[model samples]
Target chain A: MLAWAIPTYTPAYPGYGASPALMLNVSVYVMLFMAILSLIRISVAVYTNRPVCSEEREFPEDLEGDDGFTQVGRMNLLHLARVMIPCVLLVVAIEYIGYALASFAFLMILQYLIGSRKWLQSTILSSVLVAVLYIVMRYGFGVPVPGPQVF
Target chain B: MEMIFAGLLDSISPASLMFLLVGVAVGVLIGAIPGINGPMAIALFIPITYYMTPLTAIGFLVGLNKGAFFGGAVSAVLLRTPGTPEAAATSWDGYPLTQQGKGEKALRMALYSSVAGDIISTFVLILIAAPLAAVALFMGPSEIFALISLALTVIAGIGTTSICRGLIAAGFGIAAGLIGTEPVTALPRMTFDVYQLGSGLSLIPVAIGLLAFSEILLQLERFTVKGDSEHSANVFSSKLEDRLVSFKEFFSKLKTLLRGSLIGIGVGAMPGLGAPVASFMSYDQAMKRSKNKNEFGKGSLEGIAASESANSSVVASSLIPLFVLGIPGNLAAAMLMGAFMIHGMQPGPLLFKENAQLMYGIYGSLVLASLFLLLIGRFGLRLFCKAVDIPAMVLYPIVIFTCIMGAYLGKSSMFDVGVMLTFGFIGYFMRKFDYSYVAFLIGFILAPEWERALQQVVIISENNTFMFFQRPVAMVLMAVTFFVIGRTFWVSINDSRRKKAEQAMSAEQAKNG
Candidate 1:
């Protein structure tokens, strides 16, 4: 399933003299080879009764319940959902709402989600940050902040 | 001598001096803030430097790099949070010193050592860059490819805990770099027909996402923990003078500083090994050689000196490869190269001959910047120390916003923002899996050069794949690469064996009990 998503050298543009995908092939093949090698090593280790995929040494006691090495603890999932979901949403939101508004929304929601109890304080700070960033990027630096064409 | 003097005068202009000071101040503030680093800071400021003179602009950036090195130590000491990865080793002893109410002393030691290291390494750069460039001028594409390959191997070996993971990360990075249109054919290889991907991923977004946004996510995880919020509030709340170190005390650690500076210079001159590696290596060396070995990781001043000096020295010496060969040693140097290109200055052997005055001026600026870093760092320590007290909730969100804005500012592309977010997720997973993101980043950065050189080599050899083996330098590098990979694997195997044996012995003891 994962391999399908990994881009391979397709030789798409045949008319262009030499294959332009040479280095691409080199990189993809090397990665695929390493992944296979790792899989084999792990299989051998498990089969030989000396499993090397254990997280025992990689993590400390405090992090023992969390994922390390090959361990897929619950915390990894929680963290992924907590962090990545918002980031992904922010990326999507920026295209629709614009950078300033999306950033303000993102910051406030992030703060709230992270357990910031001072809602008013978080709102003010997030608003101010968004405004300041908008001003600096849009006006001061002349870098266009993604917004309505009128702006 | 006359050109040196002229260059010195050129660098000391009021406008240049002002920019240098401003750069140091800005760099220190950014560096002292957790989740921000020199490369990100430089990337953010590169657009601003477009309007300034080359001398003033490069000087300001160099000063920023130097100041950030010391500034990173500030957060490491006072908050046990390294503002940059290079400061990770400093936090080992620095945080202990802070716990013992010697935070100011640690900061002062970091400042002095940073300045000393910067001075020595800047002088070393001045002395060796032209000569190295002269030597490098004679090298062919094959030789360059060999050198770059050696760099990749060394980075893969030293940058991660496992050789497999490191190589895997490098492969992925190279693959990522190969996305977009192939340089020679102008045909897209891995873009999957996405128009934005056809232009290739810009370095700014990828870097900002990897270093900054991933860090923001990590910090968010910490902030979610109930105890961590209260802990952040209380950080660096003690009286300032109680933690101060005297001049005599700082001078006592000169030997350690010198040793670290040498190590940093050596590592920095190498193409791929960076400040974080040098700092940790120096700290390890210091711990091994110390009479009071037990004092390490327990408020030892020597530990702070070792890490601070080595990391700071890397700032100046890392430029040697960049200036002489036009090949940046690290991300920060790559940004500086971008600045150079923006200013119409190409760095290489011909640059020394064609732009001697400018080169000398840059050398002068480096020395002046070191002085500025010391001055700004000494006075601004108290101000930056307060940055540790800022709530992560307030700080990180603003950083996240800035990161997004910075990415957009790079090429004014929403596509870059998406790239940044994607890499942020990738970086987060990479960290969790204990893969070396540094090696990955270096691989991505070097991939274009690698591809170019490889293509050149192929053409020169008339498609003979084995021709590289005939070239002495290429053969030597290939041999070294194999040796390094083999050694790393062997070490891992031995380590696992020892660990298993110990586990078995412990099990037996438990059984007996």
Candidate 2:
């Protein structure tokens, strides 16, 4: 988590006139309190032999027989990894390849991973969605979609 | 009076009216789809509204909120799934009604009650917002801090079954909010010297990550595990006349509708207590008073009316706090506040005084939205019902694309996208752990304001924080805060004890058998 932080600091901002450490101190105290409370909660859960987190066992009984997709199913670790890895890579790749190509690639890859039966249909849909979004952002809303600057 | 008339005309103008219709249509479509909610939709649309006039933008968003409330009920009735958390109570009677082939009746009841409740609450907001804002103007910084503290405590208590977990989430949220430069000194506190962190996390990224992206991740798990039961074919049979509800039958439950509206309006006006609480509470009350209580979880129209009315009414009445005190009552209102600030309008006492015309314009928009909700809902009910059949596999990937687009568009920074993804993971964990994300969100939204108010109090009292005790309003608010926390703790303890006892009894029964 600390790796996300920048290493250096400078007191260069214009408004740092009398330090308002009071608010900062209070916020830190609240965080400490929360940390302590979380410890206590875990301790209680262990002592009671109850699960620390509610187990996702099945869909709610009311939705038991529905034909439509249910959001809660068994945790698919492999499927999750397959989706998450590429998503993270896509975020990184966007900086180099730009949003248009990165988005199109991300969607196509994700659709295949999620088990899209028709590769041609997935490709066309991904292209159409990406084009529509790019046109709307670049032309309709005037937001600049990054082009291939590095590549 | 003249300004009010002008504002009314402005709201009803062709362009504004068109946006309102669009907002309602979009909101209803999104809301009918499971796992997508109003807050996520609103957050996603915030950037789009950057080019819109303030009145049209606000009118459109407000219409979206109103339409989503009723749209959620469509899935609850036909698909036995809640499109939003607030619609969970609707499923108690709604799904059963569908099984009994009265899905259309249930949907119509939900629609009428939602609109009736929403219109009444809008009237309440219009009538009370100005006077409330006037009263809020008199509060000192100390008084305001105490009031916020009380609101946080109440919210923490009512938001979750476990008050301790709720407070923990809120505390973490406050810490998260305080990560940027300190408000008074402008000195970096916990930014770790990151330039992006210096501005604090943008509300858009955090909101989208928590509400939208996290949901997609959670829903993705469904792909791997197939259900045991064979999928029931023809969830909604095409015999339309069998399900149509008559006006006379709906009118028979007018008393339940009014009761639910009152409960909704009351809960919505209070910060932290939101639509779910109001809907469940009203459902419980209606069940207790019902002549045919046995029919409650088995397709009672009155039960559907009770839950839908109460939840829908909250859409309008929750804006009361935001309009009067510049403090958002819930996540949806917080998003609305962001829209207001983006349009260069601050929401408090001065807003009513300086922007009376705009306030009246907003009120006019609400009235127009209610009428639009009725028309669109009546004509487009089948379309929304069909929306439920959309597969999660296709829908969620598209939603993810939108989420990313929204995060990037907010500040046009990749750092914001990273922030959104990180928070999405955090939100997923929070949900699994039974932590109240709503409390966390409210805490994050209020932290900056709370700190600023506390600083003002310290400066005004010359650093004598004890002076808070001397202020009658401040003292009263503090006392209320303490009382609420204490009561919540007591209730939580008793609940735990009861659960333990039940567990022990079940063990003994199994041994005897």
Maximum-DockQ candidate: 1
Q: Tell me which residue pairs clash in candidate 1.
A: none
Deviation in Å, model 1, residue B483 alpha carbon? 2.4
Docking quality tier of candidate 1? acceptable
lDDT of 2 by residue, A22-65 (tens): 44455456656756875787688778766443323233431333
Worst 10 residues of 2 chain A by lDDT: A1-10
What is the C-alpha lDDT profile of model 2 across B355-464, one tens digit per residue?
A: 88888999999998989998998998878887877766567678888888888887877788888888887876676556778777878877878888887787677667
The residue pairs found clashing in candidate 2 are none
How many pairs of residues collide in each model? 0, 0
| Highest-TM-score candidate | 2
lDDT tens readout by residue for model 1, B1-513: 777787788898998989998998888888988767898788667656766899888998888877787788888887788888899999998888777667777788888888998899999999999998888788787877887777777676544677788888887888787777777677666677688887788777887788778767766665664235423222343665555667776778888999999999999988778999899999999999988899999989899899989999999899998888777787788778767866877666767877787789889888988888888877778888777677876777677777777777777777888888889888877876768776777788778778888878877777787877778877887788788778878888888788778878998999999
Deviation from native of the Cα of residue B456 in model 1, angstroms? 1.6
TM-score of each: 0.88, 0.90
